[model samples]
Target: MNLKGKTILITGGASGIGLESAKQFLALGANVIITGRNKEKLDQAKKLYPQLTAIQNDVSNPDDALKLYHIAESLGGIDILYNNAGVSNPTNNLAKANDKITEMAAYEMDINYISVVRLNNLFLKMLQNRPEAAIINTTSILSYVPSNLAPTYSATKAALRFYTASLRNHLEVAKSNIKVFELLPPLVATEMAKGIDAKTITPETLVKALLDGIQKNKFTIRVGDTKVVYFLSRFFPKTAYKLINPVKNSIKLSA
Candidate 1:
């Protein structure tokens, strides 16, 4: 769809892929609003792009999403909802860290999976008021297979993939103009992927791919390792899961 004169909202858009997308969209003459949990970061982004609207909203919080929806409505309604907020950690060897697993499950599930769903529901009303609308889910290459560094993060992305397909199919069956989009990115060199030697998917390449896909009407757009990981996971579900999910042995038992 045409980005010009459109109003777009991106979660976790203060930095990383979301930030790059905001910059691109703004350049295309779209009114971009980026939401984040950090006030300082939001202020910094506003300083950089005087035209951009930066809102402080924690996607992981349901109440915050509701509040944000209202705020977005006041800003001429939302034409696009980019569900991009997420977090990850290195879990190559998590051993017996129940605390860590618990934390990861809560944070990852909320930020990655639950928040997306909430925004979709909250914004659908506003989006329907528009001539056309789109929902962009920021899934990852790890959504198909497990990630060596983050088990929970991968699982949540996988869940999001399934949800995105289901939601799109439902909307299509109902004959709605509201489109569902999935953006699966490969491991990119960012603060999130620091110290990792995995090939980085450049932000520019990613945003370009997304725009190209949207123009071509491609819904499930996976760049770089996304297709490979998803294929491996689908064809070799058991093995891929095992590989991604490292063994968590009890040291007491070994002793």
Candidate 2:
């Protein structure tokens, strides 16, 4: 759980929450390596944080994932693999007959859920060998209550939520030194959340809570509205559903 002197590899680290996490992790005296699909953004991130090791990688690509592992290995391997890359297609899935619905859903699933599993499987052995290591998976508040406007995205996060929990339990049962941490964040004020009229928390605030949770050995790190939604979703499922999909935000499906 101790981040100091540890090497952490964060996916989608060019901007938003990932970039903020890299900045904060560096401040904690940890070696931070970031990967993203955009080469320009990666360069910019490197320019901003000279200490960051930014690499161009698409988490959805299996080849890139393998290449990333080799690159990390060359850099002495990573103690923390932060699966922070995710995509949300805000198009209402049931609104109309869209030919690309399956494609969009698949894309979100690959990056948000499948890629996490891939990265975990790739680095699990390395993490187990370390004295202290962790895998951080970023799920959303939508995992607790589905969002009608972003149904596919919600489903992906929900799937990731279950996967993270199962992985954590599996590791514990096997007496593995690798720690699995699930970060459930509410609507964050990032480029991804733009145009979504909802109360949001800054990336700095969310990552701060995440780091605090990791240090405290809290496996499930829920931030801001996520905590309230978690509680409500358990006892007041209807209210939780309403909160996530208000009347104004509900979609009307075509007949």
The prediction achieving the highest lDDT against the true structure is 2
Show pairs that collide, candidate 2: none
Name every residue pair that clashes in candidate 1: none
lDDT of 2 by residue, 77-118 (tens): 999999999998866657577888998899999999999999
Runs off by more than 4 Å, candidate 1? 92-97, 234-255
In every candidate, how many clashes are there? Answer: 0, 0
lDDT, each prediction: 0.82, 0.93
Q: Considering summed lDDT, which 10 consecutive residues are worst modelled in model 2?
A: 246-255
How does each model score on TM-score? 0.89, 0.97
Best by TM-score: 2
Report how far residue 187 has shifted in candidate 2, in Å: 0.1
Model 2: runs farther than 4 Å from truth? Answer: 251-255
